[model samples]
Target: MSESEKAARLSVFKTYKLFVGGKFPRSESGRVYEVTDSKGRWLANAPQSSRKDARDAVVAARKAFAGWSGATAYNRGQILYRVAEMLEGRRDQFVREVGDAEGLSKSKAGAVVDAAIDRWVWYAGWTDKIAQIVGGANPVAGPYFNLSSPEPTGVVAILAPQESSFLGLVSVVAPVIATGNTAVVVTSEASPLPALSLGEVLATSDLPGGVVNLLSGRTAEIATPLAAHQDVNAIDLAGAEEVLAKELEIAAADNLKRVRRPQPVDWAADPGTERLTSFLETKTVWHPAGGSGSSGAAY
Candidate 1:
């Protein structure tokens, strides 16, 4: 074969890995699936991850929690913003990867990639401000003063949307982290490439280990344990399979885990600030009043 012919036919095997505790490794199952080109030609095999893999990611996120949630808001904001920079540097890769995974034309894929990166930057700006936005002072019905504020909901487990994998993943992760919640995200089962690539961007972007644990596997098998996991204070079902999403909602009821049901989003549609709402938790405080000189509700 001519050199050009040899190069043209050279098939690259895609090795998919799970990201946990800031490191990437093969799925414990040691299995992979054959991806295909638009014409249905073989591309490469990705990891056939398992429920065990999902559990492992959760453990990592749980372990990383105390430190990550404890991080200074400014520091967390800086790291979250750095993910956008990393995404920008990897734009070409995403353009190609998303095109292949979502079957989009190159230009369309690039546009989506650009939007996803921008979304991360948008959320990074929220890290320091989200708390102030969702929370405020309230008039007391009694002799005491009261204030309500937002707090992190502890470790969050997410099932990211599948269609617009990159941006959907960003939507889920950004809001969760904006309120100081660390997360364990399940890679889209049929399309896990962009999600894993995102993990690399996040890791290199100075995200603390376990701040975002990514597992590639069957979404249902993995997410069930998480919704029921007592330690997981919240579960973002924004990407759950139909039966699975319903099941998790029921399972979440067991522990009263704050469940966010999946909503079909038109990625091309403008997402208002409403996406920033769920991650917030209300903590209302009351203080005793003595003098009339006391503050006005004390924010």
Candidate 2:
């Protein structure tokens, strides 16, 4: 064969973009940063998200909260399962990204990607069952029906873990949405491509627009405002450092955002119900019951 015939075709570069409200858009700031593979080879220019981008994501998540939270548990479970399906369909792409992002061998990256997909399936099963597990009836001295249930706390801000980028990101984000809370995720600063690509999967799944908005940029830059935003109902500082986590916690307190402090974890390990309950709020409801009076008033 001639030398020209033996040459490989040039690969088409993919432009990595931010995912917000189920659409891919360039950063509102009109800026981009070069992403590289583990060996320092050029990958693509990922969006450099801004503070306004963070705020916008919060708004999108807020708008999506009611519908998502109001959806039937069975329906939500199916939707989450659909995410797993989409992830499975795009397995090879994620395998490549994970391998490049985490500097793992192709085999190791495939394992990680497989784990992430299974994690989604795990959370999917929890949607219908969690409320029954965490909520129940209580006996009271008065003639009333007292019941408590876990409810979505509205929009949540998440800092995806820095290491184990894809699996960790899925671990954090899945539970939040599985329990009906919408999310604004700030992907790992060092390895954001996988997280950004996951957004594409979410959009293609049956999930509603604005349900899970993702941003890729400085973690603190995006997390700080989300912590303080009044509309935000919770914050997960999984990716923040000691000093930064402390600062974000303080900011979260301004509006009493339910904060999940950073803790070391094996993202590949079996995640129990804690993450599902972490972002949920228990609501106790009381209804008068059972007594008939001669005065024609019944309780």
Candidate 3:
């Protein structure tokens, strides 16, 4: 082995801790699952994330919702950008882990990792600005002046897409939090190692506690409870099967949570700014615009 390669091996990843309430802790259930590389070689132990664990995460997310959503848009934008900076700094480690788990060549893994990291930068740029595009004043048939603007739905539950593990996961989470919404992401089951690594990235990022929760377990197992949780304001079924998606949709209807169904995605196709629009609600405002008395100048 080359000198640098030997050093890398010596410093290979240890089993990571779950990020909950801005702290790294082992799963509340005290269970750990064996994570393996593509060739079936053991890599590390990932948290055997549980139902109780999921519920705990939900509590954290709900607790952080008010502050995260109420944070100034400009400040949120800057914090989101900090995540991109941290990810960029750790690109090599991510590429290595993704390559090992997905069995891709180093170059291919690097490209995928780079794309995922860049997606955050793109979303960060949108946090403060997309509001202007998605909301605006409209000329209504009324005497009072009228205006409209967007506000975030609180505490989103996300089923992160399985196909593009890191990128898809980040895509859903970034947009949800970018608009001041807190989230809990159910990470990819088969390839959850990357998700754990991502938790490490977030622990270092300047994000507030509970703003984003990462849980790696059966999506079917955990998603049902979250979908039905009355406190959860919205659901993004961006990665669930039709049956699972339908079930979530039905549960969401009980509280009328804003549900974004999974589309047949063509990865090459542009996801565009649709994600930003999903977390927003338009509120129309009106007030009297009458003129002051013209005779006041006589004084």
Candidate 4:
């Protein structure tokens, strides 16, 4: 190596884009923000998504919901498992990003990455089995057969946890889609690289476009409209502060959206099916057990 002949070349920086509708697009507003590592080293410019972008994501999610929700549960499970597989293939990339974004030791970052992958796998298995566990035949006094089952509530907006970037992002996103709900996620404002990279994995994992859209920007800016939007079916405020969560919950009432308030959560802990159930709607059907069954169905 020389000065001119033994000189080190400048490193090439990566430009991170937003993941929407299975496509990598610059923010329609052409806005971007500097994303820095924990040490304040410049990493890249991430898309500073706008409200129009949020609306576009919601539109895409709503458009894709019927097909995704109607797909066989086994197929959905396979697609989710494929997300885990894709993440595994790109393990080192995530480890590096996690370490940089969260300022964790390599081992700690690796553990976070591992936990994220496992979280996807866990939710994958739940796709096909949730209906069975949350629903069943009801015993009635009348001669009627009654049964209940879970159904997706349609497009969901997720505010991903700000602290535990990778693990928290995975924990919030996986369960929403596991039970057939499509989502538009607002990633952590401070550390969104891993979540942005996750869009690449999801794009290749056979998940339908728009089934899961990820945005990187201010949470309140993006989450407010989603909470108030008449089209959105639910809003998960898992990552908001108490006051902000309360405000968004009240806004969600504008459209009667299913609202999930923030709870004390440890992303590393075992998360049961609560997340899955939060966005699900129960449907019950009743039918007379006897006679010709003409105009005899029970309400």
> Model 1: runs farther than 4 Å from truth?
1-14, 37-39, 141-143, 292-299
lDDT of 2: 0.92
lDDT of 1 by residue, 154-213 (tens): 888888886667878887788788678888888777777888888888889888888898
Predicted model with the maximum TM-score: 2
CA-only RMSD, every prediction: 3.5, 1.9, 3.4, 2.8
Which residue pairs in candidate 3 have backbone atoms (N, alpha carbon, C) closer than 3 angstroms, thus clashing? none
Structure candidate 4, residue pairs in collision: 1-6, 2-6, 2-7
Alpha-carbon local distance difference test for all models: 0.81, 0.92, 0.83, 0.93
List runs of model 4 lying over 4 Å from the truth. Answer: 1-10, 291-299
Better of 1 and 4 by TM-score: 4
Candidate 1 least-lDDT 10 residues: 290-299
Model 3 spans > 4 angstroms off:
1-13, 267-269, 292-299
- Residue 109 of model 1: what lDDT? 92
Candidate that beats the other on TM-score, 1 or 2, i.e. the better one: 2
Q: lDDT tens digits, residues 207-292, model 4?
A: 99999999998888888888888899999998788888998999999889999988889899999989989999999999777654
Q: What's the count of clashing pairs in each model shown?
A: 0, 0, 0, 3
Q: Give the TM-score of candidate 2.
A: 0.95
**How do the candidates rank by TM-score, highest first?**
2, 4, 3, 1
